[model samples]
Target: MILSPSRGETCDHCLAVTVSIQDAEPWCPHCEWNLDRYEPARRPPEFGWRWIDRRTHRLAYRLTRDQFDALVADGIDRRGPALARVVTIGASLLLLVGVVLVAAFGVWLVVHDFPSLTIPFGLAALGLAVVLRPRFGRLDESAYVLDRDQTPSLFDLVDEVARAIGAPAPDVVAVNDDFNAYATSIGLRRARVLCIGLPLWGALPAQERVALLGHELAHFVNGDVRRLLLTQPAFTMLGTAADLVRPVSTFALPQSALMGWAGELLAEIVQRVLARLLFTVHVVLVAVGLRDAQRAEYLADELAAEAAGSAAAVNLLDTLLIGETMEMVVRRDARAGHGPDQWRRSSEQARTSAGPILPALRQLSLRDQASLFATHPPPGLRARMIQERTAQGPAVALDQARLERIDSELARHYDRTVRNISWGG
Candidate 1:
């Protein structure tokens, strides 16, 4: 389907009407046309020298390309969550084994009366403790948490969508100024929180809002919330390990300049080696976590399409491209003393101005090959998936009056929040 153009311009290549946010230049979706023959292509998976690279990408996704195709063809229940569960369990077990090894080493050193070894082992255990300790200290403190009483209509809509999708309603809902929406679990109890970026929320059309909400809510059903809870510790542990080996400044050394210089030199050399080693480990952990995260994103997209219709789902993704440019426009206008009313107008104008640059942005993005670290698939890939799996269904019907009421409730809060946010500060 041709996306509604941001500026309502017809594609010159195909003479077909295009959606502004959806069609990035060089390639026209309507005609399957490419203007640039030399554009970098997506790299093919290789099994020989690039075995680890290939395995990383495969491990990151819930299904292989062929499996996704088969799943789409057969119309079966998604196995993403189950597959992700196995991967998460494997990662956790690996981490547990490492912890056990470290603890055993520390105990052996203590028993053998090796002060030097025991001291390092004790520090290692302490660092590991810091890394593995789950933290959700400031989750709700950072945002404006909404009460059901404060947003009855919005809660009503959320409840309706949750029921339709068979996902639990989020325990906490909040609004912020970002141009994104996400779900996060907090604390040991793993309470779910849904945060909606007010700027993005306000900018979406009513139908697209349904798509966005469905996409975020679907994370709960797809086990993304639980997976994140399980996997984040690996990243935290790696970060802690990095910090433990990071070089300390030698500037505070005693008054002897020669001694200080030698200390500084030694510190720098040690730091450089340790940094490289720690960074390699960090990269591997990120690679392991990324596949499942990306898979979860695609699965969520599928659920969103199922709940909100293919068109809206595609539009929502397209809007993400537009949203990036919108943010730049908002920041520029804000600096120029544009108030909330002026900011909204400037955002619309920015959306139109930024449309032409999207194709270039997309082309630039293609230069970076897919990796385990990428959180989402490239826009072109996601768009194609949605198009290929396009299902014919009506979006969940929302009461227009309730939607309008929700808008009113959000507008007041958004304006206040945006105006108060000091970007420079």
Candidate 2:
């Protein structure tokens, strides 16, 4: 029998009754569960940028999948290193062009004295810089940064993974309360930082922990981190430009009756036209960048499999589905005034309870239409790629005693973080 979720219905997974139906899919905002699976079968073709992106992504997937399978069959593929160079050069050029455009506009304004053009050009330049600038100030506020002294064992494990992958070690390591892990490059120097979510780490087994690290550290090895830094700015700038030029309500204009209304209407029309143009540019850039991003995900998965066996890598991906469910449990427990220890136990319980449905949940996500703005490919596709290419082997061996010690240390950090965290309603 087929199952479907209705409006105002409670999610079977999270038990939240606030499920909203969109396009016939029941979505739980609190737990992020989509009850209905999205199937893209023989629908009418999309027009414009989406159609172009659909074709581009299909080609990218084919090329990258072949390279990934070949890498698994033999050894590391040269595509990763070659692509890294291309990304770095492309990003540098893009940033350079933004700078030149702003400079040329400034020179033109000064020489020609075009005061009327100054506002738009200035806004565009500011928007470009806003998109391209790297900000790291919030990192300190949101997560605890660990130095070698504070997390020696954890650093040691990270170093081991870096050596295995032949990539540079991250400049800093941080721990947060979330159920996800990510790597980022910061500031003008682009210093690398690896952030591990404490709750997610606590939920994983030792082998799976290694798999998670392998996947994240592989980003550096495959140059995915650098590529993101290069390609993301244009897309960001375009979005920012659109937002900056979007029309404001006429009601907010000066109260001069007819004159004010007419002037506001004219300005609104111009703003909307400019905003649409900027949005179109944003869509094109996003479509182009998505192909690169999805390819990087596949390459990173291959590197992860090489580092931690096929089974462990695949297990890690499966575990991620449970991580979302576990997060909902954590939040629910926290709201009920549960302490840190209880939160940890609740996480474990959620993980166990989710085991049966994890596969189904992942399949649902895979069935969803691949969006032009998504950073990674569908999870089901990733699983298939892993199964096809990854060979079975023992995960990277770490001393059990040291692993236990790191776990204990992180647990303490999690307790402190939970206690100090404030959830303002």
Candidate 3:
């Protein structure tokens, strides 16, 4: 992914720069002129399977999106103790019961004096229980956590945004050098954390920052069942179990002719069988979550409009849709040894310069079905929805002075992020 320009060559669309000969053909680093044309061929396999699972995912996406849209169109809002929620609760309970039953069975077998079975079956059962054990999402200790005492202005902004959305303020705020922001609750205590990406934050206008904050914090109160305490663990457990049981490459067998070959073959068969079963269940769980997740996203968008304004929310979606362009700006800056502030300045310049290409990018999003399998709806669709709504002024405004204070508080982290991006961190 080195960015280079050959002699007498420039991007056809942006005329900014072209990729190196070693990189993919006809790809422009600046405007992503022809990137979408090769997306299908370049997409990797899912769930350790090839075309079969990929096709399944596409089908699931279509069905889920169609259903969600139709339901919304009919003014039918399904949330709170719906059938999906019930199934989610039942599924989690069943998984827990299965784990307990397996552990109990293992213990009973060991005490029944079945020595032969004890070593193989009992231990295997106990091991399966261990792997299937429920997971509570844990706090990411590796993240650069912003201390409240040190970054009070930033925390105060977050608190204001949370209040605007009628959600509790996050217990922690962390920063990263990515193109996204997210909110998640960790551990049994459900301590919520708000993670902001410096690249995206720096690129955003102040009001749009409030829009971004509103969208993320709204996840807490938007009936997003995937983020719920009980269903969240259930939604993740099966996929994790499948991953844990997936066999390594069968091609890398032992050198031994007889004993090793036979043992490896048996283990591989068992692992593959278990993996398939777990993956099937995981797909089902994900399918169940999809419709509800899609609904939650649209609702969160509405809340974002309420907190910020319909125009700002729509503007935020437009900014998000240009993620590839922003990425190119960063990549080129990294190679050119641009200073730390270049991220923000270059990003805004790229965005502004590429105005003519923005419409095509939006159409490309719809053409590629880019957000079909994603948690959120397509940016184009979200923006359109926001535009259709009655426009409201910002309920929680971020004035230039306040934004400057917030920026001052995050100055060190921003510098570190820029340095990391420049040095290829």
Candidate 4:
């Protein structure tokens, strides 16, 4: 459906396009360029820009090549993966060490005749697989067609690139308001869909949409999705263990963040209680071997960029809106605010074809750790990567003024809408 108009025409501030004569109405619904700028809607960012996924570079709308490059390099943090690999090796070694240690500790439990959880845990594992397998089966049936319309949107573009990387088509799809696309396993290759949210596709430019899809597809092709699922049982158990350790750490007030984090990770040490002694060795063995989750995200980004070309990666941030902090939204309404509909909208909106695709990364505070870690990489890191090798284009900064105008216009439109309703009543 075509969206309605604002109070008047002439686009409030700029005379570039008027709402009165707009084909779609409401200040040119087909293209919602930044309102504050007097510049042409299709202009590039003032500074030259470089895309992060590839080694090639370009001039941005305005941001300098040197400055942007520094930020991008700083933003990406693959250090976690390196650390995780070492930990995996160390964890493996600890399994062997833990066996002897646990055996000594078990003498007390054995003599005291503590109940054996071996059978219980085995039963639990079986029960869990039984329960989850059906769920997976159900997902296989529904994931591809779950959406009301299942509009193919970016999926077709995604499939083109994903096939090269060996990813199958998604079995199901969900259209929501958010700017994200994720794949969950369904049963036996039937309906494993590459679900795309409508809001995201609608919001971004086609290239940006392609980039996003390419990234999600990479997750499937790289077996990241499967590994994620397989780790669930262990991850759940570890989470519970972490919860238990939280109190102990708080009670002890370990000297530093490292020690505190280490204490919480004692879930690793505690879970060996349920598994075989041999399993404990395995646990420690593989602990550091797995890629860091954050690193995996970066890897996926790179893969997507490569698949679609760096240009896709270049405008990715533009399409993504920071929106509300998930924590805040959860706290406020608990359910209504972050509902599926809103999520889908966010996704579709991120694909705006007119002007820029996404909103800038909203900087929350000087010391907000949550904001920095909210995305796969810090904004500075991703932004820098794109601008690293370039020196000419419209700077994304120009959008700030336009965004402010849109927000004000939206607010006014709503206010008038309320006044009209009250008067009629």
Task: Go through the candidates in order and give the clash count of each.
Answer: 8, 0, 0, 90
Q: Residue-wise lDDT of candidate 4 within 296-409, one digit each (tens)?
A: 555566655665556666566544433233222322221332332343344444344323312212121111211211224444345345545343232111133433332233
Q: Residue 31, candidate 1: how far off, in angstroms?
A: 11
The residue pairs that clash in candidate 1, if any, are 3-19, 4-19, 4-20, 5-19, 5-20, 6-20, 25-359, 60-291
Q: 1-425 in candidate 2: lDDT tens per residue?
A: 12234555886678876332224355564454553333234223444465564664455444444544554566545255455345444654675577667756655654565566576666665555555453332254567888787778889888887777677899889988777898877765768888987767765666677878888887876655334555545546667768878986635755668787787889889999999998887666665555556667777776677667788788777766455576666666655655445665776676666665555555555435355555776675576678876376744765568778786667668666555443621
lDDT string for model 3 (287-371, tens) is 6675568677777887788888888898788788878888777767755755335666887787677566554454444425433
What number of backbone clashes does candidate 2 have, counting pairs of residues 3 or more apart or in separate chains?
0
Q: Which residue window of length 10 is worst by lDDT in model 4?
A: 364-373
Runs of candidate 1 exceeding 4 Å displacement = 1-77, 81-88, 100-124, 136-140, 225-227, 249-275, 328-372, 421-425
Measured on C-alpha atoms, candidate 2 has an lDDT of 0.64
Task: Report lDDT (Cα) of residue 169, candidate 4.
Answer: 65
In candidate 2, stretches whose alpha carbon ends up further than 4 angstroms from where it belongs are: 1-96, 107-140, 225-228, 250-263, 329-358, 420-425
**Of the candidates shown, which would achieve the greatest lDDT relative to the real structure?**
3
RMSD of each: 7.6, 8.5, 7.2, 17.1
RMSD of 2: 8.5
Model 2, residue 234: distance off in Å is 1.9
- Which 10 residues in a row give candidate 1 its minimum summed lDDT? 32-41
Q: Is candidate 1 or candidate 2 better by TM-score?
A: 2
lDDT for model 4, on a 0 to 1 scale? Answer: 0.40
| 13-97 per-residue lDDT for model 1 (tens digits) | 7776544322334345455343222212345443234656545544533233443465457643445455545665566567756
Clashing pairs in 2: none
